[model samples]
Target: MTVLYRRVLGAALDDLPPQLLALHDSADPRTWSGQARIWRGAGILSRLIGWVMRLPPQGDAVPVSVSFIPQDGGEVWQRDFAGHTFMSYQYQAPNAQPGIVNERFGMIDVTVAFQTDRDRLVLEPMAWAFGPLPLPKALLPTGQSFETQIDDRFVFDVEIAMPWVGQIATYRGWLLPTE
Candidate 1:
C-alpha cells in the first residue's frame, strides 16, 4: 500500500536515501528513538508561542522518541522529547498539488511543501492557520527543515524562525527504528 508520505511525495519518494525511505516506507504503526539537541528563543513572544506549541526545552543529547500511527488517509505522529510529548497529524494537503502535505498540531494546521536539496528532503511551510483563522504569511515560521541519512540512521534538523521574533525552536537529531 502506498503510505501517507509516499502518496504526498509521489515520484520524489524514489529520491530519498535508504534510511529516510525506511522510516516512511512502513504502513504499520511503529516507533523510532534517538538523541537530540534542542534550543529555544529567549524572547517573551517566542517563549509564549513555543509554550503554546508545546515545544521541548533546550537540551543536549536529549532522548527522543516518535510514534507514527497511520490513520484513514493521514498519519499521527506522537513525539516524546525527554518525556515532554506533543503530537501532530499529517496527510496530503487538501486542494493542494502533489508534494504538499498538511500537518496539524492541536488547533494550528500548516501546509508544507517538499523539496530535495542534495541528499536531504526539505520541508517548507507554505501556509498556516490558527484554528479557522488564516494567519499572516509573515507569522509563519521558516528556516531550515530537512531530513537525511547520516551514516546508518535517519537524521533531522529543524529550525523554526518567525519574522521579527527570530528563531523560536530548533532540534537536531537522529532516529533509528525501535527494535
Candidate 2:
C-alpha cells in the first residue's frame, strides 16, 4: 500500500517530496490521519478534474519577462530573460495542546531567483533581499557589487524570510549542463 507522490512541471513529470510519498503509503480509510487524508483526497480530485479540464501547474519553470522599474525613481530596465521567479505565502496556528508550548506565528516570505541564459545577456542584481548581504567581499575581487554570468543552463538562488526560522535564510542551486 505504498503511494508515490509525483509532480509534473512543464511536460516533465517529476517525483514528489518524500514526506508526501510516505503519507500515501500509510493512508488508510479506517485509520487515516486528518492532514494525510486531506492530501489523499485532494490528489484523487486532481486526477478526476484533470481528465475533464487539464490545467497546467502554474509553478512550472519557464522563461519569464521582467520589467525593472526604478526602485529609486531612476530609469526602467525592461528586458526579456529566460528565467523563473516565485514567491510563497504560508500560515501557521498556535499550539494549544495541553501542557504543550503555545506560540504566535505570522506571515513568511520566500523569494527565488532563477536564470537560463538562452540569449546570454549578463544581468547583475543590485539589490537582493533573501540572501546574506554584500556577496561575501572575498568572492568579489574588486570588493564592489557582485556579477553574474548567463550560461546555457538555469541557476536558482533562493532566500527565505521566516522570522520563525531565522532573520534570513538562503539556499542556492544550479542546473549544470548534463549534455
Among these predictions, the greatest TM-score belongs to: 1
RMSD of each: 1.1, 23.0
Per-prediction TM-score to the true structure, in the order listed? 0.96, 0.20
lDDT of 2 by residue, 29-123 (tens): 21111100001112444334322322212232333332323222121223222332322221111332211111111121112111213322122
Pairs of colliding residues, candidate 1: none
lDDT scores for all predictions? 0.91, 0.23
Model 2, position 151, has a per-residue lDDT of 42
lDDT of 1 by residue, 87-162 (tens): 9999886577988888999999998998877788999999999889999997888988999998899999999989
Against the true structure, candidate 1 reaches a TM-score of 0.96
| Model 1: lowest-lDDT 10 consecutive positions | 91-100
Which ranges in model 2 have alpha carbons more than 4 Å from their true place? 1-58, 75-147, 152-156, 165-179
